[model samples]
Target: MRSLGVAVAYPDPGVADELVHAVEAEADLYLALDPARAAVVLAGEEALSTLGEHPADAAVVGVAADRDAIAVVARAALRCGAHEIVLWPQDRAMLRSIVRDAATRARIGAGRAEGRIVAVAGARGGVGTTTVAAMLARAVAESVVVDLDPVGAGLSGFLSDGAEPTLAAVVAAVDDLDPAALSAAMAGHAAGRAICAEPREAAPTKQQAARMLALLRATVPVAVIDAGRAADDAAMAAISLADQTICVCTPDVASIRGARALIAAAGRGFPVVLNRSARMRLSAKDVARVVGAPPVAVIPDDPAIRRAGEAGRLPSRGAARRAIERLAGLILAEASDGS
Candidate 1:
């Protein structure tokens, strides 16, 4: 919500009213003369060069005076990530219309906004990947946890309140997406978080999964994909699009082998999670040795985790609660640093 910097090189006062009103409507843009705190710059010949400019962080809204060619502005806008351009209109009504459209595009990139993708996949089935995913989602703020299970054992029953969640309905509706469609696909869990739980009775094609993940990142600031047990080609594609991957490993040798193969094969990084710590007959260090990195986190063995998943909330309070909080903080800190 930083203020937008607007430099009007239009050289005419005739269309000033219309242009000013247009930027006012959009909350994303703040019209401030101070160069230090601008989200966007309306650069023209005057002070533009003096501002020590060459694509500083702000998005640029280029305006040409008395020239009502928006199509020209649109091309330049896309290139520089400039949101919009308002041509000075002698007609007040036309100026208002142009500014409104430009404001809409400004919402796409904002510094305070967080853009992230974290995928959770188990070494194999029944190792608590889904439970950990729900926990991770619960820990983050303003984020969505999607159970994109292509094999489609829907995540609905895990919630304490039996709300049947299906992502298929939303995914099926979108071919090309923007922010608006993303908002529609998400539903609130009673536990005060959002989840996309869709039944995948028929397996989703690799192409479908790839497209879904692409569109999800296009709009939301943070996206958490929960890949239960096996990671199909589609799941692997999801991992490739991730900022990081959390591989849920138990202390069994077979699980460690599977996790190692997954890490070696993936395009990005793997952050190991040793779930259910106490029951593991093998040591975490031994397991980490196989996976190639020291385990980044270990969620201790706790029955409350099952209760957390069943209630559709992460284990907010537990014997191992500190570990969960630490993992959440690590992810958040990584995301913030990325910002």
Candidate 2:
């Protein structure tokens, strides 16, 4: 096992000495010269001001003197974004345990490859962006779908009954975000997990959106973001981070025009998926010509898919399901090749 680095930031020399002694007592733990390089940072109340300078992935353990000091410092720690609060002397064992766990997490994160992110955006509303995102997530192994759309009924309404600690909550804690915090915010679904947006909640800022996506990339094998139409800052943020952006649109004049504009704005060719294909006279080639790229997948207008969606489930077997599965395979292949 690799030794874990511990960094201490306490205003009082006596308290700092105690912290250093506790860390040195463990054979696996060693003092880190740079706080940013450490797996865990032990900070006293006054030292909490330096929290912003450390890496967000570092575990922050706030140290307080006693029960009385803990009460005062705990509240301050929460505001300053500490992950945990430890009482000096009394919680020495707990501190050691926290350091060990943090070390394990840091090692795992450093060893594993970062995940692929796919952003699904629609040419316009009602073009099946959410459906494509949800189905793609289901087809991909060890995947999660994130609902970044704020206007339409969230992706959770289509997949599950939406869980607590929504996207809004996650964005609010982006400054101190961790894999554990994000995992708790996800809702369970037969397809996979989802971080659904709360209805009518304010959109995430660009910084918050970027931070959330970064954490997701570090945590999951793959993440599919339902970016709606890619109109707002949050949607653009997802697109900016995505390894691939799938543009979904129907084979119609208006929809094709919208898709062309989106493709042009992207300044690069993106794979387009023709949703509800063969329902109109426009063929895949016609739509592809207008969109400046070939249709990667054509999902037929399947009644089974509609029926399954109405019941908040995906079609077990159908042409549409097979097409989505192929798309998922392509995404996985591209991600692997990139790696």
Best by TM-score: 1
For model 1, give the 10-residue run with minimal summed lDDT.
105-114
Once model 2 is optimally superposed onto the true structure by TM-score, how far is the C-alpha of residue 252 displaced, in angstroms? 0.6
> For candidate 2, lDDT tens digit of each residue in 144-251?
898888776457676465445278778888888667677777778646898888676778877888878877776678899999988889888888778899899997
Instruction: Write down the lDDT of every candidate, Cα atoms only.
Output: 0.62, 0.81
Model 1, 1-339: lDDT tens per residue? 224444343334654444556556556544555545554556433333343553354545666553555566556555555555555544344543343333333433332233578888888777777767766766776667777664645455454455556576655654554445556656766323445554555444567776566555544656778877645666776777677788988777888787887777774557888878885376688776787677788778888777865655566688666786688889888877863
Model 2: residues with Cα > 4 Å off, grouped in runs? 1-113, 159-165
Candidate 1 residue runs with Cα over 4 Å from true position: 1-15, 21-28, 32-114, 152-154, 158-166, 190-192, 202-211, 267-269, 311-313
TM-score for each of the candidates: 0.71, 0.70
